[model samples]
Target chain A: MNTHAPVFESVAKEDVAWLGTDPIPATAYYDPAYFELEREAVFRRGWIQMGHVCELPEPGSFIRRELEVLKASILILRSQDEEIRAFHNVCTHRGTQLVEEAAGKQSRFTCPYHSWTFGDDGSLLSAPDFEQFNVAKEDCGLSKVHVEVVAGLIFVHLGTPESGMRESMGPLADRMDELPIARATTISEYVYEIDANWKLTYDNFQENYHLRFIHPSTAGQGCGGDNPFGYPEEYGFQGPHRTQTIWTNPETGIPSAVQGVSYMKIGEALAKRDLMIPGAEKNYFALFPSFFLFGNPGTHFSHVVYPISANKSRGVIRLYWVGDDENASERYAREYGMAMTRDIHVEDRSVIERGQRGLESGALKHIHLQTNEALLRHFFNEVDGRVQAYKAELEAQGAL
Target chain B: MSVLPEGYEALEPFVATYAVDNAGRRAEMRGEAPSEVRDAFYAAAQPLLAPALDYLDTKQFADYDSGDKQLMWMMLSLAHVAIAVEIQQEDEERHAHLRSFMPVTRAPADF
Candidate 1:
């Protein structure tokens, strides 16, 4: 058996020590109380990626996202000024959600409950019985969420973060900015509402260890054999964020039967061009908590894991194509790439639910981590560190 | 009572043919329907779409007028036909159906 050692040299200095020895406690996956702690410690305070700027290509366009775990209904929109912003979807008057549709475009939004209106910039424009209210209209504008757009991706912080997304991402920004993400357009989206914890759903994407076992037919065939996958070419951490690069096996050739697909040609063309991360065909960059971007040469795909409860989560995978100019070749390529990625996603879904069931059973006390699973260890360490610090702070205040 | 545009009495039976199953799954074509079938359906049903869309745009759908509802049903049925054609095209062009399955059958075993 060939076993490759998982390297932690790229992990943050504080997180490096927990690599091999830490057997992740089962409670981290299935415990309801711990899940609540995670919401407070992690999801609430950090910068969460909402969507990409390209999604709102035209000024005045908007998209609404319902984040059930954070108890947040958010509207991320581009104003008439062409700046993207995020705001609570709730009306300030009676707290009725201002936007009803998942997405639409308008320079102004009027709450359906009352006639309260707000501009795309979130400034209150008007409300019913304005003189009857003592509060200043200026003060009652839709509440703003801290929003920043970096490398074409829009991120919102629900609570105050110590630093902005650009600063927090550090060197990772240069790597992500180099991609044509700003010019890339979204082609499609895949949404999965699963019966598993958000972290469990995310952990499945963080490693390539299960490719041979779990994806034996779909991804395994694409990789070229039973053991076609390999260790991440390069991996590292920037604050709470991290990334890993996986090189495509150059020897693998597409079966002629599948060659008509434009997606099949994308990999071969990308391998010849040095557009992606150095020495890798695909790179997985993760913003700690639940956002991940998997970038290949001609395309990039993202996954947002949103916790619905301790045991339920919603995963959205959005695919983007960098070159918008579409001819016959480009159209075929996009379809092929989307179909291939989708099948692999279906394979992973089965195990993620089953793994959660195993953790809930309480028969297993600790889940073992293999040598190549170093990133999983690094992830747990960061999560544990944050949750513990939050616990400590609450204890100090006598609030826990 | 059902409201009918004067002289458009044939609309009810056509709309009744399009009701979705209780499971909300699209009603399937009984046998393999060709693209020409979809093209013909879309061509014939194209005129009905405008009034239904107009009702949707003007928010008259909320009123649930029987005639408008019948038009909506016809529009939805045409969409199902187009979707089934697209699904077939995806299967033939990419062999997507073949790659996504494991060979198993519920059909009666040959004697």
Candidate 2:
């Protein structure tokens, strides 16, 4: 039997025209003022995916995350009752940072400046000369922040949340629960710090229009047949979040000998665990603000962009695996998958940095977007809507 | 004593350059290596990837001694080199600089 069918048809411009064809303001990508508004309006109150539940496995396990965007440090851990929680990594004694180590297992944290001890549940266990201070021990617990785990991904909110991340995600939350990440027991990570705006850096990945040019050699297999650029077959939006069904050319015939073996090894590993369900990798999730999760079962990964400032951001890409490497081939497959993906990501940096430099020069008032770049357009629209609403709220209060 | 297993003696020359156990150091070696060095290793090991994996599959991981560990580490290094030679090709010189920003902080093999 012979079958010839088109894998994808171009998503028409008119289908997404309601998002508007007007050029998006370039200033939003690099402007200091707009960045300030986003910090307050969007990031401050919204849920940011910064860590995974696997990082905090036991009661004493804790990891310190530096939230530069909020100028705050967070200590996420599992308490004695086996509950996961997040707290301001600040000691209530005198505002000194409590935990300094990046990650470790510790039940008691004693402030080095003064040996004020705190328990794993953020309770003030002891302070020297207790009667001398007017504060009660109950009032001295470390400041608490909202932390929730959905699909084994840890998200934290710095300010008051009108709705939690899982609630906000709605149906996408149930969909995410079925993916590989929900069952991940371990992870491999690669991190990059780039001198580009967070949106510009994230937008680089949201669209595949530049794949053939920017990643000519590494991305050859993904681009061919009807979709020369390997564009997504379909795009679905839910509130501020979105998902895309990635398309792949089944017969590009470019997998190197070692690369082919590595993928086959990974495929077998997934198949043994019954993770190779057909269309299991149907689509990937891009949570609001700056987070992305690929749907590929063999290489289940999430990329999050952390904003350090207007023109500087750090991106951490983590590949979640269900268990440890069982044998030589499994280990080799993980290495090849990681190294190949890293090379593809490396190709995107210089071009995105160049894009940021061009935008900063203040030459272009706005930037153009084609039909295929609808995801970027949607992200910009959602972000600007929030920022503009926050500005209006401030003006109403006479605080702007 | 040989640096690799009995059947994989041909890969002994790469033991010193690619047998580093840490993922960070292995990736650094790939970046710092010159074109001739990377190309020669790729040409040498390209044919052995399948056989090497097949050979290692014959033994349990815990039973491996020093020679087997070295060969295993070398094959891991081949993963990085294969991408450089077969994919990046002539663009490696510029690609190396781009990789400096991204570092492998954690992997399953690291533990």
Best by TM-score: 2
Candidate 1 lDDT by residue in tens digits, A1-400: 9965333232233444545566789889889999999998988988888888877979989999887889999999998888888999989999999998888889899988889999988889999889998899899888999999888888998998899899988888877887756556544555677899988889998887788677654455434322345555567777788788664654454442233223344554344343444532466888888888876655467788989899999887766666442222333344445545655675677589899998899988998876556677778888989999999999999998
Q: Cα lDDT for residue A279, model 1?
A: 37
C-alpha RMSD values across all candidates: 11.8, 1.4
Model 1 global lDDT (CA atoms, 0 to 1)? 0.66
Judged by DockQ cut-offs, is candidate 1 incorrect, acceptable, medium or high?
A: incorrect
- Evaluate residue A344 in candidate 2 and report its C-alpha lDDT on the 0 to 100 scale: 87
Q: What is the total number of backbone clashes in candidate 1?
A: 2
* Fraction of the true interface contacts (Cα pairs closer than 8 Å across chains) found in each model: 0.00, 0.85
Per-residue C-alpha lDDT of model 2 across residues A45-113, encoded as one tens digit per residue: 799997998998888899999999999999999887888989999999999999999999988899998
All candidates' chain B TM-scores are 0.47, 0.94
TM-score for each model: 0.74, 0.97
Residue A238 lDDT in model 2? 87
Pairs that clash in candidate 2: none
Alpha-carbon local distance difference test for all models: 0.66, 0.88
